[model samples]
Target: MDARQRLIETTRELLHERGYVGTSPRAVQERAGVGQGSMYHHFAGKADLARTALERTAALERERAEALLGDASVPPADRVVAYLRRERDALRGCPVGRHTQDPDVLADDGLRSPVEQTFAWLRQRIAGLLAQAQQEGSLRAEADPAAVAAAVAAVVQGGYVLARAAASPEPAAAAADGAVAMLEALRTPPRAPHRA
Candidate 1:
């Protein structure tokens, strides 16, 4: 890869492994194996590079989500289950959502925009699917799509935290299973056939 791309990729990894405070320009330069000149030439500074990296991470995450949630052929509840059960590095935490814990990233509007926007888009997208299912009489009409979407999002993030805290992947897996069960419960039961 070119110097610019290398810097961005390196920064992305550093940011994921270490928050904004830990990902210094020197660390990025050393990790990228590029000189300070190359970094400065490509980005204004650490924040600039971190912002680019965060944006890239957010985009990739959105793409993966879209792939799972975008299929109309799949039942909406199933789509949600697929998303909750999608392969993830549970112990490593979310690439984009992890940034919300970083003070530096949260303090800077430029750094936080991508993270905020990504989550907002995710909740809205999931809510849309739930709404569609409700309209189709597949999901209970009493269920609130927006509220459920937010809870679903929280469960995933919280699952990561639980796994990380417990130092095992089981917590995350259990959380996904629980989420799937809850979603299944939301589906309307098939009506009994009538006898003459």
Candidate 2:
């Protein structure tokens, strides 16, 4: 690979392993086998390289989520469950989530927009599903779909935090499983007609 590609690839790996705060350009250079002059020639500095790396991470995440949610022909609830259970070995938060938690990372608009947009798009996708469920008479009218969608998003995101803080992926996985189960159970069903 070329020096710029090597640098971006190394940056992605380091960012995922240690997050933005812990990753350094020198470390990336060492890992990528690229010299400082070469890396600088391609990227203005650490921030620029990191931002590009983050955008790549965001794009990857977007692709994954889109595959799960963008296929409108798929059943909504099934899509939700499938996304939650996607082949993740641990609840290491989404790459986008890890980036947003970084102070320096979030402070940059160029870097932060993709992260913000990912969640925003996910929430809307969930909301649309909930709306579809409601229109189909499979979800209760009493609950607001948008609010429920937001809660769903919150649980998944917060689950990552809880699991990471506990140093165990179980809590996060459990939270996701539990939320999905709850939503599934709460699905509306036809009531038996009352006999006179």
Q: Candidate 2: how many backbone clashes?
A: 0
Backbone clashes under 3 angstroms, per model: 0, 0
lDDT of 1 at 75: 86
How far out, in Å, is residue 174 in model 1?
1.1
- Per-candidate local distance difference test: 0.93, 0.81
Residue 36, model 1: Cα distance from true site in angstroms: 1.7
Best by lDDT: 1
Residue 159: error of model 1 in Å? 0.2
Model 1: colliding residue pairs: none
**lDDT tens string, model 2, 36-92?**
999999999998998888778878887887798777787776677777766654556
Error of 1 at 94 (Å): 0.7
Please state every model's RMSD to the true fold in angstroms.
1.5, 2.9
Report RMSD for candidate 2. Answer: 2.9
Top TM-score: which candidate number? 1
